[model samples]
Target: MAEDDDIAERRLAFGRAFIGALPHARALGMTLVDLTEGRAVMEMPYDARLIGDPETGVIHGGAVSALMDTCGGAAVMAHAQTPAGTATLDLRIDYMRSATPGRAIRAEAVCYHMTRSVAFVRATATDGEEGRPVASATGAFTVERGR
Candidate 1:
C-alpha cells in the first residue's frame, strides 16, 4: 500500500511539473484536468487574443494544435512504464469544425500503445459536447530510455 501511494504521488508530481514546464501551455491557459495510467485530459479556455478570425470569433488552429500536442505528451507521460521523457515525433490533426464561440476547449488523449522507442496517442478536442469534436489528432512520440 505504501508503494502504491508513493507511485501515485510521483505521478501527480510529474503531471504538475510537466504542465508547469511548458510556456505555451501557460500562455494559452492550459489546465491539467486529469492524469492517470495511459490517459490525460486538459483544457484551454478561449481568449480574445487567440482568435484566428476576428469576424467569426474562432480560436486559431495553431492553438488547438498546441493543446493537442501538449495533451498527447501528457498522455505519454502518464502511461505506466513510460520512458523518462518523450518528444513528439509526428502529429497529424484534422479539424472537423470550429470550436463553439465563448466556450473552453477540452482535449483528451490516450496512449494506446508503447514500444521500446515510440508511443502512439490519439486525441480529440471538444467544446463540452458529446460526439462533436472541433479537432482530432494522432501522434507518435519518441520515448527516451534510461533516465
Candidate 2:
C-alpha cells in the first residue's frame, strides 16, 4: 500500500513538472489540478489576452485546444504502463460552445487505452456549466517505452 502510494506521488510530481516545463502551458496560465492513474485534470484561468473576439469576450478556440491537448498528454503520462515521455500524435477536438467570459476553464482527460507504443485519450473542457462542454477531444499519443 505504501509503495503504491509512493509511486502515485512520484508520478503526480512528474506530471506537474512536465506541465510546468511547457512554454505554451505557462504562457496560457495552465495548472495541473489533479493527476491519478490514467487520468488528469487541468485548468486555465480566463485571460483577456486569450480572447478571440473583442466583442464577445470569449476565449479563443486555439487556447481551449491547447488546454485539452496538454491535459491529454498529462493523462497518458499518469498511466501506470506509460513510458519515460509522450508526445501528441493526433488530436481531434469538437467545439460545442464558447467558453463563458470571466470563468476559468477546466479540462479533464482519461487515458482509456494503451498499447506498447501508443495511448488513446478522451477529454472534455468546461466553463462552469454542468453537462455542457466548451469542447471535447479524442487523441492518440506516442508512448516512448524504452527511452
Per-candidate TM equals: 0.92, 0.93
What CA RMSD would you report for each candidate? 1.8, 1.4
Candidate 2: 10-residue stretch with minimal lDDT: 77-86
- Runs in model 1 deviating more than 4 A are 1-10
- Which candidate has the top score in TM-score? 2
How do the residues 1-147 of candidate 1 rate in per-residue lDDT, one tens digit apiece?
999888877887779788988998999999988888989999999899999999999999999999999999999988887688899999999999999889999999999999999999999999998899999999999999875
Provide the clashing-pair count of each candidate structure. Answer: 0, 0
Local distance difference test values of all predictions, in order: 0.93, 0.93
Error of 2 at 18 (Å): 1.3
lDDT of 2 by residue, 1-147 (tens): 999899878877888899999999999999999899999999999999999999999999999999999999999988889677899999999999889999999999999999998999999999989899989999999999774
